[model samples]
Target chain A: MAKYLLLKHYRGAPDPVNSTPMDQWTPDEVTTHIQYMNEFADRLKETGEFVDGQALAPEGEWVRYDGPGSPPVTDGPFPETKDLIAGWMVIDVENRQRAVELAGELSAAPGAGGRPIHEWLELRPFLSQAPETAE
Target chain B: MDERLLRSLIPDTLRILIRRGADFASAEDAVQEALLLALHRWPKDPPRDAKGWLISTAWHRFLDAARSEQARRRREELVLAEPPPGPASGKDDSLQLYLLCAHPVLTQSSAVALTLRAVGGLTTAQIAEAYMVPESTMAQRISRAKRKLAEAHFTEPGDLSTVLRVLYLIFNEGYSGEVDLVAEAIRLARELTKLSDHPEVHGLLALMLLTEARRPARTAEDGRLISLAEQDRSLWSTTRIAEGVNILQRALAQDSLGEFQAQAAIAALHADAQAPEETDWEQILQWYDELVSQTESPIAKLNRAVALGHAHDPASGLAALAQLDASLPRHTAASAYLHELNGDFATASRLYSLAAQKASNLPERHHLIRQAARLSGTDANGPWPGSGE
Candidate 1:
């Protein structure tokens, strides 16, 4: 069976509209959102289909290796970028069709104020040693 | 008289012609033409000596094609000079084809196709089917590869590693169209082993066999992906596993380890386990370490992280994963798994969603989305009814 990595990102949603800002969202709202996502992950784990997953901080540096005797260079946090990645997940499954099914569900991750984010999640397969019977 | 038997004899015949100085491309085309002729003629009147019939017919066809392409004067001169008498039959000439196919001039893909056709005796259609390319395209590829090799003066033989790589690519293609590439690869590997004494060749064959043993239990009834932990051990093929293990043991005894040997060692460890928990993660990790040293591939390191996760703490796996660049193949998936093991559900879920979207093939994409849905407590129903899609 092939495995895939599912990347989660926000799309088409207005940036935090509340006066309180995301950091000041009521503790209950924060708790509820965390619980909701947690419940989802726990359910997957129960099925034994869950492999692993993680959230990413938006801020990061891009490093480039030039060559021998060349110093590595770094750049980051471009102000012009729009699509911000929130996090990612990985699962081993039989094929691509199954990957889409799972992506549809993740696209509905609950966002700020208990609204479905309908986020854009990208799915990528892990290319491992082809299964023994593949050829 | 069966098609299978006829196909089985193709490699040997092609091998004989090649040894006598035919270039890989010409030798393959000649052999293929001979097989086509066999398919037409054998049913009506099976040849008394099938190998001899193919070698003689293919040899002449090869000469005819060579003669036709030359200037008339040169053709006449060559014909007047007379060709070498065909070697006595039953010489297992397939090895020569292997060497020619592995000619240094041919790119990996062309070499694989030529090898499969000439040494495996597989039809061009079969080779094309295996790669999911149009038959015409494959034909062009094979022809171009052959022409390139001919121009490069690629008459010298290649090492067993080249042949093994070709077989590995063939096996990796999985089943496509009407071709059973896995079985074909195994058959070719077996044939190659008979012709060479390389331990790595034996290691590669062993690795392929061991992995193939679990094909029956690799997927669900509905064609959904099944994880190793979830696979039914009972369904694994004991006979193939035994054969693989035996070969692996003999290869290991040589102690001149190669990548295939390391991979086979890992597979052997997997086979030894009766259940998922019983799997020897430490041994697998060791093999992966050896593999990384030998191959220095990011994928090997990624695999090693997974082994570490099972052998030690998930956190340790995550730590190892963190050291790898995200662009490395499977880095995201490996990170997601490591996070999931660390109880970072939100991160895991998000990664799953990303993986599902980025998936290149249908099965892997579907599997990723399923993971996302299960984590989020949402419906996991996908567009496809069954996984074979």
Candidate 2:
């Protein structure tokens, strides 16, 4: 069977009620979010559908190459950009339909106010091998 | 049933489950359960009819979930009262699921995930590994996507081109986790081609084949990246190249040229030549021109410059490079390579160093650094040329 990747995005999603800065959020909220995400992962594991997931630091550097006698330039955390990604998730499924189903469930994860965050997600499929004849 | 047979039947089984009105989410869960059951039972007492077994088992699992969720009561009634089971009657449902997954309401990423789950029969964990994300994150992503599908009004099927693009991306990833991405991509592409006779499908398949034919030579013995020019020609898969060529020939015969077909045509040119020097660079440049006409992308322009260097004068190639946006990834490296070819060592060295410093990934950085070191006649321990700091 083929594998597909489900991507989640928090595009202007409402901040949870306990939405303090990362450092200021009550320990319980932070712990709860982490624990919930971890527990959810375990559930996927039990079903043998668990793969891997990670939280991305919402910052990145851009590097550019200048011509000969020119030097490379670097940029980071540019002030103009607003749609910073908070984290991501990936899931394997049979087809696009199934992937959509899983993404729906993930969006239901409890957020700041212990309510569903209704976050946005993007699902992409992992390309597999060439057909046998092609090989 | 042999593992191979079981694996092959997964897509078909998933199609059936989805066709039976099992929402993409529930259908996937049911399929996963069926696969798990098969892993346990099939190894011991193999099913005489593997597809039948999977269909029956997955169908039952879907019913069980539907009953528990208390959703789709009307649909449940229809499923329970269906005609006695014969050969899988769910092919239509599966096709519909493909359409729904590719629905325009959802983002491309969600559509791809939904397609893989409903059509490919993979699990969230597998997809997560493929994307280097946690299973929980993947779960949430898929769940959100399905919810969108559930709410979406998919009046008509999506364009085949969109679906083909998604599958092409999958094949390009090559491999992840325990999954061979190339094989998965081909399987999906083959299935897609059966669903639609679009020439681009063939074009995509040919493109994948031609590119994959060089897989053996794409990497060095120690997993280092090897440029196409430096690849060991002997290791290139002639069989794959032939297959790609044959497919491209058929696609071209249609007299309709698409971006994929154009790209595949370029690949075919590379494959036809026995040595790099023998490559039909002029013809490839023509194809690139066609590609640019079809799709105006900076990366495409950058690639065209490389072909220009080979097909015409190096100075013209440099001029082409100058037109591209400097911020584009690999622009510096491409320019540096062109400079190196033009016998401009100082320029090449500087560009290489800049490219190396700006490299996003480790392997690319290492490669650029090596080039810089070589051009500047320096060792690793010493300060890079022009690095006064």
Candidate 3:
């Protein structure tokens, strides 16, 4: 078994088939999209593939230590920032193919006009301890 | 009265009940209940016939369970058709349990969880914690596995190789958890040895031991991955090395070489080295040749390229790598290493960064980032290069 993180980047990633933003979509479309997400997670739970998932807030700022005596520095949430993550889902599956398949299915969640979003999902596997015989 | 001794009795204890015509799921439940009773009463009131005590208790429970279910009559007939438990059956039961738990129809994860529960005698919670899954999720996985086996109706013992593969997965596919999967794998391998005369079985055990011997120096106190070239040779377990070599020699003498034996030979060569410079890369490459020929596994081919770097030269390694699929896991890392060996620091640094981006685990990613930063004249402990988190 292997664990994979399916990442949903709000920006930086290529445009989806359905490019309309969620805020621009009709209220009915938004509800249907959300329902699809909930149903997808429930199905994964039944299959025992889902591990964890969360939707992130759009707002964020960069924080850093200033110096030995000063408070931490906080930078603006610059509009110019190109990278933005919408959410992520963690899954444990039988193989990479299964992980990719599930991610593809999730990417098919209904979007604007009640059609598939076809969003690009970044699938990454978890690094584990090198097996004893790997060396 | 020892916990390990109690656990050691589990597989056969459960198997005997199943052999007496109880279904796998019911037999398991009955055995669990019997085990709980043994744990409670064994310390103060030990049974003289522990195995017999477990079987009778579990069998009674199974029968009682069958009575409550609708298919009670048919199940009772199945139990009645079987011969009474004989001493000769115990040895085969253990192996059969391994076969049943690791049946090919089930997914790898399901087989692993089932094996840990039925053969390794671990609690569902314990298995859940080890795999880093929720207890409910693990429970579902195990029950689904049992259901799948029942549907498959596979009664004959499965191939030994499938069981070996599952055990190998158990040993190798571990990161961090309360349970020590490595030791658990070795224990199961040892148990297998008691039932079979297969040379490959010993080969697997030897491979695990020889590899594990180097674990003392595999990581630093702060949990950083240490390259093999930098590992302290003095920290290696000589006892384990000796035992492993002895086991490998026995397996090799049979002259029926398999993939695990070939890999073990490579590990034995590495273990034989007293220093990094003293490592027998030529011998390692040779064993890798045997391994590649036997399995044709892509990972083995990738590893052979790495061995070529040291055995011949970095140029040959780079040429060999260029011929293979670039998308293979660790391909970028191998390229970076060969470039570093060829004194192409810029290329190595770039590839290291790329490899870091593709790294699957946090520690390996951190290590690769550290490598990339070190080569590029940046802070070795710099923040992530391409990670979104």
Highest DockQ against the true fold, candidate: 1
Q: What DockQ does each listed candidate score? A: 0.03, 0.02, 0.02
Tens-digit lDDT track of model 3 for A11-89: 7777788775443344356456656777898899999988888765444788999999999999867464558786799
Q: Give the per-residue lDDT digits (tens) of candidate 2, residues B226-290.
A: 77887888998999899988988888898888999999999999988888889999999999999
lDDT of model 3, residue B181: 85
- For model 1, the stretches where C-alpha displacement exceeds 4 angstroms are A1-135, B19-24, B43-45, B70-73, B76-93, B155-157, B378-389
Model 2, A96-115: lDDT tens per residue? 77667777776565544455
Tell me the spans in candidate 2 whose CA falls farther than 4 Å from its real position.
A1-135, B1-4, B71-97, B378-389
lDDT of 1: 0.73
Across B178-296, the per-residue lDDT of candidate 3 in tens digits comes to 77889889888989988887999999999999989999989877566788888998999999999999999999999999999999999999999999889999989999999999999
In angstroms, give how far residue A118 of model 2 lies from its true place: 48
- Highest TM-score among the candidates is held by which one? 3
Query: Candidate 1: TM of chain A?
Result: 0.73
Tell me candidate 2's fraction of native contacts, as a decimal between 0 and 1.
0.00
**Candidate 3: docking tier:** incorrect
Count the clashes in each prediction: 64, 72, 2
TM-score of each: 0.70, 0.70, 0.72
